[model samples]
Target: MIYFYNLLLLILCYLSEINSARILGIIPTPSISHQIVYRPIWKELSQRGHKVTVLTTDPINDSSLKNLTEIDLSFSYDLYNNKHNFSDKIDKLAGKPLEMVNAIITMNADICDEQLKHPKVKRLINDPNEHFDVILVEILQPCMFAFAHRFKAASIGVVSMDAQSAAYDSVVNPTHPILNPDFMLPLAGKLSFFERVFSVVISNVMRVYEFLFIIPINDKVIRENFGDDYPSCKDFIQYLDMLFVNVHPILSGIRPNVPAVVNIGAGLHIQSPKSLPEDLKSFLDNAPSDVIYFSLGSNVKSKDIIPSTRQIITETFAELPYTILWKFEADSLPNQPKNVKIMKWLPQQDVLRHPKIKLFITQAGHQSIEEAIFSHVPMVVMPFFADQEGNAKRIVLKDIAVKVDHKELTKESFKSSILEVMENKKYRENVKKLAELLQDEPMTGLEKAVWWTEHVIRHKGAKHYRSAAIEMPFYEYFLLDVIGFLLLVLFIVIYVSVKMSKLVFKVIFKLCGGEKPKFKRH
Candidate 1:
């Protein structure tokens, strides 16, 4: 009986141990917005007794989480901010498709180089004994997949936005250019002829761009940092077992996905709004009318906005009776209006949840849109770049928001959009309906993500879940070979039939004493 008890205890401990895993996350991008999408996932896994190590630009240094180890690459942020003014570039690259691709590739390559060279990351990479059950690399930086190969672990991709981007094509199911909008284009469902042509052209161009430029950059960086023995970037991408996309069908539109592509779009990492600071709470509680919250997201500082545009925005808000809460970085604006309030930062999601807040003016970032949808607030979107344009266009198409061109933001146009969105009850209703659909999911995004991460660990890569299409060549995927075979058979039949007819004719001609047709040879 004592021996039996010992065996039972051992079994129980083994069962408990099976639930945990060692997960390595490579989130080299310095953008705070990108970090927000991933931090909750890593935190949840750590809390669940799994060992989680992250090489990140934004590190959560909470001491209490014993299972989590963060290798800080925050220096990448300073390097990026010092080298480039992203706010100014947003305006310049808004409509230029080729330039946008070039800029994004350059930025991602630079960040990847910095992360691979960081001392802590270098040490971890070179350590032969270091191993992980799985490695999670952000999809934006494909070169980071080298870590998965080096660690001999299952690879999972975590994308901050929808999986419609060409960058994700290798890992996800096939994307139709006509049905699915590219990350660069703003058109949505039921596109016109011109739009369809443009979409196809742009899609092909992007694929070429990826092949000729992006992949080479990633390959060079991977070879440099991880050595030549590591697989090429494209080869590393093929080894990805699954992808977690932060997009729900309701917002991102319906598209076919393989089993490996999991949608965790509903989870926005929203916490219960903390008790508001006394002064801010007092200001919100005592608002005379409904409030308008305006923010350009984390990347675009208010001070960097052009002076004329700033004047137009302030003037437009002056006309509104509602209180205007602007997330301005500067301490003071020279001619601030009485109704407007400027803060260096604001708890955006919490503010949106407040009953007095009616409409949100935003840069139409993916996370911000998700937050607004969750809070059932309509928006006035001024899209800047990347997926923001696509997100803004979709919001407008859904009838839950109005769009204002940031470049042409005159006082008249800005105020008119705000007034239209604020006065319209339909916009509010549509957004609330969307919120219902988003919140109706059985599992939170974080819960789903964590469960899958453990699932991969438990199964040791979950290779069974991989799609057959991942191994298929472009011609095979489209069945061009099968089609060619059918065409060849038809040609043979026609050739044989023509020859038989000619022979029959010649026999008949000879029987009837008719001359056979003579052929002239060159």
Candidate 2:
């Protein structure tokens, strides 16, 4: 009996050891902000004993985590840095929705092609012994979905921004143009007649553009890399088990979401702030008054700003009593203000946590906005492109930030916006209230994401959680068939009514001895 009990214990231990899975993460985008959102997810899975293989531009090379395997695609980053003029593109693409979409699609295609051609990725693809239980892909680049299909793995999508319009198609959710506006358009709630018409028309145009142009390019790339035997991008979308989006009801307005859609917004990257470096701490501690933290995020380098705009910013800062800590990439700035301190980079989260930090001057990127909200720091936004404009408008609408168009920025305007936010305590109060609501969730975003990911792996694609909308055609989903039936019934009723009236009229005319009306056929 003793021997049998020991044998049973050993068998249970063995089962536990083999329970962990091999997770594959494909994040080929060169954008650092995107890397920031995805890195933590794979890292957490690795920490929990799953073997994680990540192909990314930014690799968190922690030697301590034995389960993590990061394939460095920093070469892609180098290519983008050397070849692309981001500042100019941002300037030109602002408010041009179609052009912006085209630019992203083209850029992502180039990156995806380069990623597939890399030797490490090629070897992984060719290796017959390799296997994964689940594959996590960046949702922006749909071409990468082929990897999930090829590996025969359960697929989970990661979006660094709010659930975009294109993502609705994957889960088969209704993308009502007015209710769920495209990320490019800065629209929310109750639009005027002209605005509503424009919204519907533009939204449909974008959908057509994606279908006609973007999907074909994606299909071509997948076929070239993975071969024609593989399923098309649309076919592979059905394999997606869940999508983790960086959206919160508190930050982004509440919208209808399918069961497979998970909102891990502020919690996606927000963690306990680490201790600031000594020099940075000293700088903040020594400040005479409250400091304003300024950064345009990693993608938008401060040096890229036009000289005149830079001068206007400097002049505005010089007028303020608050100290300014700017994330300027350059070694030095000409005519730098006495109160302004420039650094190539600063620990943003740590700085935001400081009590003396009064305001954040930001580009209003999703990640930056999340950080600001997490820290209860109000913002003065100068939005540039992509979702930044929408994010800025949302923050402004929430009454937690002031929006200053970068193109219209001047010393006076910049100074006034800053002063307005600083003087008004309501902005600070609103942000703090929002932070409380965000923190009040039942489970942290990270926990929810991990739970859902592991659930998919364990259940072999968690089909029960999938929305019923996926099985319905577009007409069926909107009950257009039902509408058609009602219309048909109405037509029959009208026809019957007209015939009855004509018969009654004829009888009445004959009874009254009236002349019959003559009908002419042309």
RMSD of 1: 4.1
Model 2 lDDT vs. the true structure? Answer: 0.86
- Collision pairs in model 1: none
Best by TM-score: 2
lDDT against the true structure, each candidate: 0.85, 0.86
TM-scores, all candidates, are 0.92, 0.94
- How would you encode candidate 1's per-residue C-alpha lDDT over 1-522 as one tens digit per residue? 999999999998788677778899988878888898888888888988888999988889999999999999998877667765556777778898789768877887888888889888899988988889999988888889888888889999888888646545766576888888786688787899999999999888888888899889999999999997677888888778898888888788788887888898864566777777687778889999999999999887778888888889888888888999889999998579999999998888788888889999999989999889889899999988888888898889999999999888888888889999999899999999988878987888888898898889888987898777777888988889999999999999999999999999888998977876678999
lDDT of candidate 2 over 1-522, digit per residue (tens): 999999999998788668889999988888888898877788789988889999889899899988999999988876567656555677778778778778878878877888898999989888889999999898888889998878889998888888677776788766778766777787765678887898899888987887899888889899988888877787777657888888886677677778888888775887677999999999999999999999999877789888888889998999999999999999998899999999998888889999989899999999998898889899999988888887888889899999998887888889999999998999999999988988888888888888989999889887788888788898998899999999999999999999999999999999977987778999
Please list all clashing residue pairs in model 2, or write none if there are none.
247-265
Candidate 1: list runs displaced more than 4 Å.
Answer: 1-15, 495-522
Q: Give the TM-score of candidate 1.
A: 0.92
Candidate 1 weakest ten by summed lDDT: 163-172
Backbone clash tally (model 1): 0
Which window of ten consecutive residues has the lowest lDDT sum in model 2?
Answer: 78-87
TM-score of 2: 0.94
